[model samples]
Target: MYKGYFGLKESPFSIAPNPRFLFMSERHKEALAHLSYGLGETGGFALLTGEVGTGKTTISRRLMEQLPENTQAAFILNPTLSSQELLATICDELKIRYRKTGATLKTLTDKIYEKLNKNHQAKLNTLLIIDEAQHLAPEVLEQLRLLTNLETDTKKLLQVILIGQPELKQLLQRRDLRQLAQRITARYHLLPLTKGEVGHYIQHRLSVAQCDRMLFERAAVAEIHRISQGIPRIINLLCERSLTNAYCSNNALVTKKIVLLSAQEALGDEYQATFWWQHKAVKALAASAVFAVIVSSSYFLGQLYGENISEKSALNITAPAVNQVVSDTSSPAIIVADNEKIPDENAAKAITDNTAKVFKIESDGDKKRAVEQRIVKTDKPASIPMPVENSAEQLSNLADSKLAEDKATSKVKEKLSVKAVDGVSDDLLALFQSAIDDTEQDPQFKNSANQVVTPEVNAPALSDMPAWVQSDLPSLSFEQHIYTSEGESWVKVNGRDRYQGDTISEELVLNYIYAQKVILTFKGQQFSLPALSSW
Candidate 1:
């Protein structure tokens, strides 16, 4: 259909075995050389094997064309026959007469030997080429090997060429066929075309079809090679479909897009569907792993630095008192004078706050101690008169309170020193430093300075609030939500359906769709739009 449209005399990519369209790659040339050498030498068996559609038959055809005029070749296109039937077919190919009704194995063999002997005397070589030799039965193959045994000391009477797929190689390796395998003097395995050769192959076929100009783009040729895996038959199928599609679309040249579509058509729905799902699964798994790593790292850094900051704040508030006690044990009078200068209620509250910040205390016992300390330190004695019997109790309580205060201060100093030492450890310090550096270098942190740091599970729903929450952005309205059912999710933005992971515009893109939320990037800002449904 497209031959005239593309200015071609014939279909360039027909799967038919045409010698004019054959592209002799390096491997093909080497395979021919092996076959030629095997036939020239006094050989028992010559072997040529390759994968399906790798030009094995083309090589065989070329070999036949180059045979010497003195050679009498018998081609067997089918090898599914009994030993006697095979010999009868050979006799028929050689024009040897035999009884049609009562042709037994002995009769066929004697006739073949007589024919071979006659050919030998006439200085004519007998070559038997069996196509699809892999399907030959063990007994039939053994019988054929036995025929080769009827040779003179100088040369074999019969030369056989076995050509088939890669299975033929395995077939020859059986223990039962070891004797026959030892007689194989020459063998060559043909490989598929290289990437560079695929281009030349297409061009060669196009030239044979009488087209002068290049019809396929370079990238299209590359895509063909990639999809077809350099197999000639598959390449032919894809190129043929691609050209047909281009011709139908009225395209002047075949492009990569056309080739892709053509491949999907030619390779069938099962392959395309399987490849599509596998690609998606791999991408999703990789994305999930990266997300997990980032989230885990961020959470760890937050916890580590949060504790460091809280401890630093506590140290700043209590460092002066700790230093005062450590510097002078004889300055107890000076400490008491400093304590008395502050108002009783204010001093007690400061002490209680410091203790609460350091120890996270929740008991009423600690608060009662603060109140008693305040009462004893108050300057106005006339405003709060004490009973005569409780005055001695107050004195004893004051002494006990003083001892407790000293012990508590010493404990706080010890804890602070220990924490300071721990904070300066090599591993801990390195961890804290790395966390700080990562935060400073993070691209998201630089872009959104005031962005809230929250866990994924605690992400807020978009629909529960107004479209634009800030009062400054009352006019800007862009609403998007996710709808999920049966394990798939879709994004709907302002009444327009958008596929996930595709860019809506230059400034807006649907990044991902989770079960509970859809992540989007709008004008350099990322938003996690929650799903309207529960799941």
Candidate 2:
């Protein structure tokens, strides 16, 4: 269709086995020489094989043209016939008459042998060529071998040449076919074109078609080499498609871009990545896809685990030195827990509300000075009531017993450890309880043993937690959760450790568990964080 527009006498890239357009390369010449040696002088059998679309038939055609004028050739395109059918086909090819009905294998073979003898007597070389010889049954090939066995003192009466794909060589390797394999005098296997020859091949075809100009760019030629892998048939296909593309666009020549688009159109998506994977855009696209998946997956998992806090859901309360519950104000407050305490409340962590009074105590000449400051970060207000008399001394005493407080922290954590793991750490609890004994006796403290609770955990959100979560969250005591990788629920909380099902004291009001490092408030004043001095 594009021949007229491209100044070509015919389509340059037609895949037809037209001998007129054959461009014999060194490989083809070598294969031709091998077939000539086997079949030219005195042939019993000559074998030629190649990969599909590698031009095995083209070489065979050239071989036929080079044969002597006295040669009588019978060519069979399909070799799938049975022994009797094969003999019948040979008789038909040489115009030998046979019985129309009830023809036996012996009857057909005798007729073919008579024809060969007559041709031999007349000084005519009888040649038999079979295409797709790989599909020939063993018995059929054996029958042909037997026919060629009828020889004169000098040469065989019948000369045979087999043209097929690579499987023909493998078929000859069978032990059952050893006699036929040994009788074959010459074999040639044709491979694909090389990169340099590919360019020459294209130019040869175009020149044969009478196109005088350079049709494919140098880069386009390189791309065709890479895509077609030097296979003549595939090269013809890609080139034809590329030319059609150029014709459609009314371009005088083919470019790398046009060839690429043609490859995509002809080969589809399977070949798209094959070429572009070496380019930077493909790598960048792959990297961007991975990053997007990681970010999206993290967010999705967080929605399932509720481990990290987003700004929309909770305030930014920095990781703190210690977890102190403020109960003096009506509003409840929680301060982020840390391994150690920092004297600077601003850098350490934020207090819940503006009215939450934080008293800072530092070593004085001989006494401790208590400096009062209001630090607020959330709408909820959590205040700690202080005794007006010797307030700094009371806090000083609390500060003095650091080892004791750590012990108490550990003790409370054990009693509250997810009991669902089905065990408790008694020794650690005893040690921690002993540590907090002195601070628990301070008169300013109003917390009863039953009033303490931790925030909600292991759920998508605090507001969505079960009713039991509020009561079961860790209390004034320290809390440690043992997470397992097995079973339906991995979190082991106190109690039967059923998810969100822990039991707390009746005196304590169970509220939604809030894990905000900063202050968080529910419907009313129910949460509070006591300053370290107050604790």
Candidate 3:
């Protein structure tokens, strides 16, 4: 199709065994010389083996052209036949006719021997060339060996040439066929063309097709050789496909890119994997990227959720000092005071009213100071003497003392209010109050206070937990799972000591178990717990 466009007389890369287009390299020349030498002698057998499409038949045809005029050649294209059929076919090829129907093996062999003898008497060389001889049965090959035994005193009358793929060489190595192998006087294996020969081969064919200009670029030829692996048939296929592609694109000269595209089209999957990134390198890069993303995401999540907080920071906040008093001392003091005092309902009501007054103080500093003073005054040693006075007198005296203390506190507040106009002690008090308010409102301070005031034996406060821990994270944790040989499934949930059934809790139940994942229903919601391979 591309001949006229490329100034060629015909397609250069046709796979037909055309002698005019044969470009014999050194290997091909050597192979031809070997075959010629084998055929020249009165040989029992000459063997020629090559890989598929290495031009074994081409060399054989060339050998035929170089043979003398007295040569009688009988070609057997297919060797897949029984002993009788093979002999009959050989007789038919050599014009040694026999009974058309019901021909016994002996009858066919006798006819072939008669022809061989007649050819020898005429002083003519009789040649039997079997193509694809690898398919010949062992018994049929043995029969051929027996036919070779029909020899004269000087040399064998019938000459046999076996040309086939490399497997034919292996076939000859069989123990039963060792005798036949011993008779093979000459054997030659044909190898594919070399890289340099591939370029010369294309030019030779193009020249034979009557083209003068170079059609394939230098790099393009190298690429063709690489893709074809110096195999002539594969090179022809790739070059033809590349030429057609260049023709389709109206390209004047074929480039390496064109050759690459042709290889992908002609070779398909065999060449698809030739790309540098399609195999281990790309997979390794992708795996590295995935691992990096996972590690970075894990670190970011730990920081955001405070999961990476140091143990020292948590312990520092939780440890209490010896002199630090908690604000909830009123409960214990009231409980102790109530146990000690067995007074009437009126005195108890008076005490309760004073306690409520003390609690109602809004300023934390003033309240703390007042409570400390009251505790100090009321807390006397057990050995201290009690005042000898009536319960009403004692309660009245206590009430009178509380009223005097309140009046004194009011006077001090009034003095501070007057000092506010002067902006002396009042500003200091305001600054102190602001500092106290800020400390109380500070989250860190509150967290530390909560940790210190609460005993470690009690359950932790949920509010103090990290945000991600308190958030709606996946409820189920897959510690481990096992499947028995009989296919019974069991799993440990949340690293619990015992194995739970499919139903773990009233609200959570196992739904399905897979090799890499476990499904569960948590509070009527379905979720998946992925199996962690490592920490």
Q: Distance from true position, residue 214, model 1, in Å?
A: 1.6
List model 3 lDDT by residue over 1-535, tens digit each: 7877898888889888777777889888888877777776567899998777788877777777777988898889889999988998888889887889998988888888888899889998888899999999999999999988888887888889999987787688899999999998888877666668899999998899998878999999978876676778888889899999999999999999999899989888877535766443475466556756887888699565453234434444322112223376544332223224432222112234324222222257545322321221123223322223244686799899978756764543343232243545765556534443333243322222132111111223334445644464344455456422122334646433112224676666665443334555556555455543211
Q: Compare the candidates by lDDT and give the number of the best one.
A: 1
The TM-score between candidate 1 and the true structure equals 0.57
Model 1 residue 254 distance off true place after TM-score fit, in angstroms: 1.3
Mark the regions of model 2 whose C-alpha exceeds 4 Å error after superposition.
268-272, 278-535
For 1-535, candidate 1 gives per-residue lDDT tens digits of 9998999998989998777788988888889999998886588899998777788888888888899999999999889998988998999898999999988999999999999999999999999999999999999999999999888878998999999987787788899999999999999977667678999999999999999988999999988876776789999999999999999999999999999899889988633532554454476666556866887889799677657556656555322222222243332222222233433232223254212111122348546322222212222222212223454786799899978756764543343231235436776545434443343243332212333222332334434434543222212223334333222234544323455566666666766665345665556556555454221
Write candidate 2's Cα lDDT for 399-498 as tens digits: 8786665676565555433322236467645543443343234322222232222222222333354566555544432122222211111111121112
lDDT of model 1, residue 237: 95
Clashing pairs in 1: none
Winner on TM-score between 1 and 2 is 1
> How does each model score on TM-score?
0.57, 0.53, 0.52
> Looking at candidate 2, what is the lDDT of residue 243?
95
Question: lDDT (0-100) at residue 77 of candidate 2?
Answer: 94
